[model samples]
Target: MTQTHTHTHTHESHPAIIKRLRRAGGHLNSTIDMVVQGRNCLDIAQQLQAVEKAIQQAKKALIQEHLDHCLEDLVGPLGAGQRKAMDEFREITRYL
Candidate 1:
């Protein structure tokens, strides 16, 4: 007897996402450095908040892309991968 196995792969915008995240990280690092250098506390706080918001926006964009492209294919009619993918999505949403 012979057995066969199948694998499915999903597309991801990893390079673009990495570039966005790196830019956000650079903003965060600069903000922290300003704070450490005795910059105005209020200004530092505002800059930090801006960096956080940017990071959140990038994360949301990546999640939306995944839902539109990857999840759509995985959860298509008659597919069996929806539950697992949705569970992962739920876990990810907990942090958002």
Candidate 2:
């Protein structure tokens, strides 16, 4: 049997996601500091939740960009390998 493959690449480096993740990390540190200072539980929880949401937003943006640019290219003018890659990407994203 002949095997065929399709490859897709992105020109956009997506630095914004990295910056957002860094900001989220800073928020997490602040939340930890609040906890260490004996702040109220509700306040700490709110800050932690904000960090989580920021991280989630960054993840969503990265995923959306990948789907829009990489996956779209793979699905067109390609073969079975590209479809397999898309399936793998979906599986990996299940954890996120």
All candidates: CA RMSD in angstroms? 8.4, 8.1
TM-score list, all predictions: 0.62, 0.65
Candidate 1 C-alpha lDDT tens digits along 12-93: 6666777778888888999979978999989898888878877787787778777766666765753457667766775687
lDDT by residue (1-96, candidate 2, tens digit) is: 998658544446477888889999999999989999999999999999999988997887788777757667655664588768876876677577
lDDT of each: 0.75, 0.81
Provide the lDDT at 12 for model 1.
Answer: 65
Question: For this target, which candidate reaches the highest TM-score against the unseen true structure?
Answer: 2
Model 2, global lDDT: 0.81
Model 1: which residue pairs collide?
none
